[model samples]
Target chain A: MVIPITTGKGRSSRMHEFWEALTDPHVDFLRIALLMGLLASLAFGMTGSLVVVKRISYVAGAISHAVLGGIGAALYLQTVHGLEWMHPLLGALLAALLAAVIIAWIRNNGFQREDSVIGAVWAGGMATGLVFISKTPGFVDPMSYLFGNILILSRTDLYLVSILDLLLLGILFVQYNRLQALCFDEEQARLRGIRVGWYYTLLLCLIACTVVLLVSVVGIVLVVALLTIPAAMAGQHVRSLGAMMALSSLLTLFFVSLGIVIGFLGDWPAGPAIILVAGVAYLLQSLLKRVAA
Target chain B: MSEPAVIDCTEITVRYGPVTVLDKVSFVVPERRTLCIVGPNGGGKSTLLKVLLGLVRPQSGTVRVLGREPRQARMRVGYMPQYVQIDPLFPIDVEGIVRMGRLKGRGLGFYTREDRMATRQALEEVGLWEQRREAYINLSGGMKQRVLIARALVNNPELLLLDEPTAMVDAHIEARLLEKLKELHNRMTILLVSHDATFVSGLVDEVLCVNRTAEIHPVERVRDKSVTRLYGEPVQHVVHGHTHHHGEGEEQPDA
Candidate 1:
């Protein structure tokens, strides 16, 4: 369906046919993608922007980019070992958590200025993927790794995304106060017997696991941006962290839906288009802030 | 308030890189005693409070509050760090900020009935109950400081460490805050730090002066005219352990 130019434009595109059967207008593919993308962005943005806080933006980038290697490695293992138990999605998630633990261990131990180490890991992982894919028997496409194809919205991806979104929401609902205390002033939280370090480690692992799957939908390049920019705008616009999270989610959905439509109509890429949409919104917000100031 | 010492620091030494901020400082805060730590800039007064509250680590020291380490017993230590250092526009409301104090026992749950009671009690204690749900950004500097103090108090800690609580408030507000502290003095031990030497006396039972060499002053030293006039007489000092002081003191010691 997403094969070549005019293939999707043809009246018989898989998505078009699927949409034609729908009761609503033919804006089906673009609409769902938009809704999913925005929800995905909203969750990611609220989480990602906090990295800019806790002074962990670069650290988070390191983790985010490093997750690529984890996914690639997991995919390779499933192929080579033929692990019957290893589903692609679960394998990807497991690999990411393992990677997160390893990174956390190393950085906390001796790999000081983990940002540089993470950057190294990022480039190294991508390079490793390139090599592994080439050496493997199948002609795997790396474009999806660098830039995701949202059109390939598999049922598995959607289910996993739904679960991840729910997990995030649940955790937030239960631990919003504790997470806030930890994020803003860990000492204060710790002094109150919050186990500041453990909760944080858990948060990082959760974020890493979530990003592993999210990157599949939005890709690494756009994942953090979509997550952060909307939250950043929300941070500026809303006076409360809770409001910021909610607003970020709404804006993410709005921009993503718009981006998906533009991508569909123009036959462009989804990942980059979604990021650009958020980026544009951010720029506008900045302009508005400056003007008001 | 016959409870044992809430904060007991035994030879705590804090260092930032190669610089020693607090060197082998030790103190015992009995229940309901207000301990005031005072010193010039960079004298490690605030650092001591942070270390006491487990905000900063001491290179060498053992701190115990309620018979546990500060980190392990953090729920028992209410801290009001220097409000000047925090971003005032941080996305929170007066009520939301106060609600943050109950985070310890609530852990990851929704604000329970107990948490609401605690938050309301704390806000009421600080006299900000009426402005509970107001946006934090809209508050005056003095009101914001009170809210921070209230947040610390929400956890019902045995010891409260307030770093320069009266720094940003007006004279009248500072006096009002002092009254509030006096009321709270019955509930918990207090450790306060300030540069306003004038407010040192008549507030606290003991004085910790960190002037390069950190040491504790007997309660009577605060009332000493020479010592009071040195920093400035009628200076705000921690009573019992509460720090209560008058606002207008520009007099410097040996200046």
Candidate 2:
């Protein structure tokens, strides 16, 4: 699993090296990383559409920032207590689900002001993570998790991402109409006996899972950008939620793949490059729409 | 007018912490008739509607919608909240919006042929069948109101509840909506909530004046001074044959 870090290499040599790494059976991290990006795009597209339309990007952002706490705790436990099974990804999934449920509970129960609670969770999660990371024994580079390193992803990460993809597809297959109703008009949906609270909680849980997937691809700070930008851009053109999901999924795949390639060519960081490309394209789309109008 | 009660509320009382939003409110709407619930803002108009729809729980009173609990009868009840309550930028078309009404508490099943037929019929009833493919965001305010009405109609409920249907639309659109509701009155029980009671007085069979407490009066009796006492001001009544007036405090209550 040792990956040689080659920087300041010529553009042509880097391109040649990436291709060589992709084809070399013994060195397949590059290929796995590319496949991971493609797989993550499916989730980014579907859940991102719901997140954007439901106007819960702040909630999603809170859930994502909360993931760092889980990762840090898992790293601390594994390093100090020899808890070999407590993988950082497992810790992340648990933390994301916990954050989603807490936020949903607060909203459903009316216990506290929602935005303030979300703000607390958003900052509190990161602060907790920072403390845990500081306490860990090894020199853990938080930057890799704060801003992801797609090249370091493993076969296990690929399997986890695939499971998440299938899980999301299955949920959407069953709950698409209900989710649509929930998003468009919650009160009417409740009048129809749609269990608006439960569906809302379920939607947040899905967003939690999607945030975990994005964390592996783009990390925490950049997850919201990748999660929302494609769907927001797609919304400007599509007339239906389904079409928005489809178009956004394509856009996500395009940005992730192109960003990966460009990062390889220019010897740049992959996660931020992907976000930068998405940000630029979104700005361009908005500009073009204004001009057309 | 003894067609059986479609909605029966017995001493319904609702309180938000220390503030009692509704107190000892009780009324009934007969089947196949239109009833307008009129009141000032924050006077429990919307809360009463929520009680009927089983959204807000009462501390001590019982609510029976169509001879069953409000939640139990939800599938048989169609509700149209103010169109302003919906997100204007929601990315759904007319057909998609109407199809949402067919969701019967089951999250897994696909839309059936019966659902599609009902959607089409609802759209046609609202006179928006031709615009079913148009995005809801692109629709005008009047058309948005119609789309909401169509959504409420898609389920073919026995009881229909509309909240502030004429809030943002013009007089002409309100008249057209009135015509549509009058046509629907022959099939189902209708309860509409409005702060401006005069706009719907011509079409409703009764008017329920609410201000923390509740009282029901026949539509013809709404012009009586007691209705004015309920509002603490003079209330205008629109006669069927006269041109509608938009000016404030210029027209007299029709005798």
Top DockQ hit: 2
Tens-digit lDDT string for candidate 2 (B1-255): 477889888998999999999998888877888888887778899999898888899998889999999989988888898988999887889999998889878646579999999999999999999999999889999999999899888988899999999888888888898899889989999999986666776688888889899999887665546566776765554434464332244554432
Clashes of 2: 0
Model 2 scores what on Cα lDDT? Answer: 0.87
Docking class of 1: acceptable
Candidate 1 lDDT over A76-177, as tens digits, reads 777777765655456456656765676666654555666666677667766665666666567667677667767666556667777777888777778777
- Fraction of native contacts in model 2? 0.75
Best by lDDT: 2
The 10-residue segment with the lowest total lDDT in model 2 chain B = B246-255
Interface C-alpha root-mean-square deviation of candidate 1: 2.3
Q: Is the docking of candidate 2 incorrect, acceptable, medium or high quality?
A: medium
In the order shown, the chain A TM-scores of the predictions are 0.84, 0.95
Cα lDDT tens digits for candidate 2, A176-253: 898998898888888877888898999999999889867868889999999899999988777899899888989999
Q: How do the predictions measure up, each by TM-score?
A: 0.81, 0.93
